[model samples]
Target: MKITSIIIALSFISACRGLNMTRLRPYDLTAELMFIFEDIDQNGIMTVFEFETVFDRYDSNVDGRVTRSVYTTYICKSDPVQYELSHYLFDEYDVDGDHFLDYHDYDNFYNKMDTSADGLVVKTEFVNYWVLLFQKYENSDIHPMSTLCR
Candidate 1:
């Protein structure tokens, strides 16, 4: 679709209902956003190992999978405010058809979200990765997704 058409569609969609809008990020070379990763280790890369560490921490049954129940458990225990963040991230990032995120899914999404087309993403991309799930990110929430909860 053309840019104008996309804008028109967005306008129409916005007119119909609410969009849980997030603030637009600043430029690529910002001082703070460049440093905002969760950084499970000091590795400086959002590697599979790092993601798995976080993922495992949240998986309640040692199942190595973040099912809905696992996700809820993590949200309630870790960051309740953004408990939905895992759902948002998993819904979009689990692209491998495995029903859960292994290294491949996480790696692909991590790379794509590296929007500068650069080899590495800065702090902001990690934060905004799930927040922009429907638009430039792709309408994938576990391969079948809803644009919103309500």
Candidate 2:
């Protein structure tokens, strides 16, 4: 009985390892955002300057705007898993449907994140907003790890 149990457990473990299971948890989003934000001052708050720094990286042309192509390239280079989320965020941020993200769009996003109407965005506020935004994806049968978006 002992030997049989051991063999069964080993088989189960091996089978589990073969599966591509990637769940998008809140912490996963939080960690990704924190890493991207790069709180240089070690403060828990995200300022517009920090956001601008991130924007500048994607805006390779220094045109003060980020195009979808540039954003996709940047995100894919950093983390392929972020591809879907990046596109969703880009579309939502592009308030004017201009196919580009500019200062105006970013400002609108910042305001959305700063739920308390404060000039700054705390980690909780940022994470909460993203988690809520991702609710639709979470509810769908489509896995976040999959390339397809529902």
By TM-score, the best candidate is 2
lDDT of 1 by residue, 1-150 (tens): 699999999988864443222222232322233334446555555554565566567666675556655555565575543333446556666786566755566567667767776666555665555444434432222213322332
Model 2: per-residue lDDT, tens digit, 1-150? Answer: 999999999988765433222445564565556645565565888888877777777888999988877787787677666555666667778999998999888888889989999799887787777777766454333223324322
lDDT minimum window of 10 residues, candidate 1? 138-147
Off by over 4 Å in 2: 1-23, 27-37, 139-150
Q: Relative to the true structure, how large is the alpha-carbon lDDT of every model?
A: 0.52, 0.70
Error of model 1, residue 15, in angstroms: 16
Best by lDDT: 2
What TM-score would candidate 2 get against the native?
0.71
Q: Which RMSD does model 1 reach against the true structure?
A: 8.3
Q: Give the TM-score of each candidate.
A: 0.49, 0.71
Residue 28 displacement (Å), model 2: 6.0
- Candidate 2 worst ten-residue window by lDDT: 141-150
